[model samples]
Target: MAGGLGSKKVDITWSTEESGLLMAISVKTINFKDGKTRNYQKNLTNRRGDLLMEAVTLHRRFPYSVLAAFFFLDAGAENDGTPKRRSTFLNAHARLKLFTDRSDPAGREEQFERFYLILLEASPNSVSVRPFKVGDPDNEVSLSQMLDEILELVAERNPDFYEFDDGRLIKL
Candidate 1:
C-alpha cells in the first residue's frame, strides 16, 4: 500500500474497484519476557510507536479508510508483576486507550479506528485466545466477537456500501 510517508505492507486489508481502500489491520506481537523485568513490556513503547506511525501513514493517504490495530502478548503478561504493581496487560490497556476510537474521517490521523489487545495461551493441546479493548479489559471477547466488531466498524464507516446485520455483513 502507498502511505503518506511511503509504501507499507499491512497485515490484512480490504478494498474494491469502486473504493481505493476500505479497511486495513496491522498486527504486532511481543511474545517474550524481559530478562530484567520478567514482563512482556520491554517493547511496549516501540510497538506503540510503530502502530502510531502506521496509522498516520495509512490514514493520511486514505482518511476514510478504517484502520484497526491488534497487539498480541503472552498470556502470562496478565499476571506478570509484583502484588502491588499493575500487570503488563492492564498497563498496556491504559497506554493504548488514547490511540484508539477514531470515529470520523476527519479524526486524528494517528488514532486507529479500533485497537485490540490479544493474549494467547498456548499448550501442547491447543491455544486459547482472549481479546479485549482498552476501556473494557475485563470483558474479554472471543475471536468471532472481535471479527464482528471490526466488520461492524467498517460498515459504520462506509454506510453507503455495507451494512452489519445479524452478525453478518450485507452489501448494498
Candidate 2:
C-alpha cells in the first residue's frame, strides 16, 4: 500500500471499502546466527529499524490502522549468550517494548499496535512454535494464540464495526 514513505508491503492485511486499512501485520525473521558474534543479535538493530519504518509509513497513511509486528527467531536464540549475559530473545523483548502498544491513532507514528516474538524449533520429526508478546516474555503461547490476540486487538480498535466474541471476531 502507499504509505508515508512511498510504498510498503505487509505480510498480512485486513481492510474494507468503508474503513481503508483496518489492520496490517509485518513479519520479520532472523533464522541464522552471525558469523562473528555467533548470535542472532547482529541483525537485531537493522530489523528493528525496518519495523519502525514500516510502522511509521503505515500509521501515517492510515492513522486508525492496527499495525502488528511478528518477529521470528530460531529457538536456539534463546540460548545465544554467555552465562552472565542475557539471551538474544530476552534482549529483543526489551528493545521491542518501547515500540509497541500504540493504542491510539494519535500515538507515536513509529509504534506498532502490537508486537509478537516467535521462537521456532524445527526438527526432522516435528516443528514447534512458541510465541510471546513484548511485555510477557516468560509466558509463551502457540501460534494460534498469538493470532487470536491480534484479532482481538483489531476488534478492540474497531469496536463499532467488529466485536471479539467466543474466540472469534463478530461483525456488528
Candidate 3:
C-alpha cells in the first residue's frame, strides 16, 4: 500500500477494507531540563523533527489516512514561574505547528487528522495535554472524544463493525 513504500512501523495503525489503511499514530517522548535551556531547546528541536518527519513521509503516501500524533515532554521545574520556560514551550509548539493542522500545514506534509502535545512536569504524577493549537497547554482531551473519532471511522468503513454509544466495539 502507501505507494509501495516499504512498511514503516507506526506507533499505532489500523485498516479497513473500504479505507485500506485508515489510521496511523506515532508517539514520541522527550526530556527537557528546566535548568538547561540550551540543551532542552536543542533536543526538543531535533526530536520534534525526527518524529514529524516520520508522519510527513507516511502522509505523503497516504493522505486519506487519519494521521495522528502524541508528543510527551518531561520537563524539570527549574523555571516554572520564569519567562524562559514559557518562551521555550511556545517555541517548541510553534515549530511543531509545522506538521499539525494547528499551524501552516499545507506545503508538503498535509495537516494531521489530530495532534496532541502532552507535558509532564517534574512531579512524577503531574501531566498535561493540549491539542496542537495555541493559547492553551494545560488542557487535556477527554477519552471519549479520542475514542469517538476512531470508532466513527471504523463504523463508516466496515459493515461488520458497530460501535455503541458508550464506545464499545461490537462486530456485527
Best TM-score goes to which candidate?
1
Ranking by TM-score: 1, 2, 3
Which clashing pairs does model 2 show? none
> After superposition, which runs of candidate 2 have C-alpha atoms over 4 Å from their true positions?
none
Lowest-sum lDDT 10-residue window in model 1? 134-143
TM-score of each: 0.94, 0.93, 0.65
lDDT of 3 by residue, 29-104 (tens): 7665535544345566676766666666776666555667776665432133355445455666666766664222
The C-alpha lDDT values of all candidates are 0.91, 0.90, 0.58
Across 1-172, the per-residue lDDT of candidate 2 in tens digits comes to: 8898889988988899998898899999999999998889988999999999999999999999999999999999999988777889999999999999898889999999889999989899998888888867899877777778778888887899999987888999
CA lDDT, candidate 3, residue 171 = 61
TM-score of 1: 0.94
lDDT of 1: 0.91
Off by over 4 Å in 1: none
Q: Any idea what lDDT model 3 has?
A: 0.58
RMSD of 3: 4.8
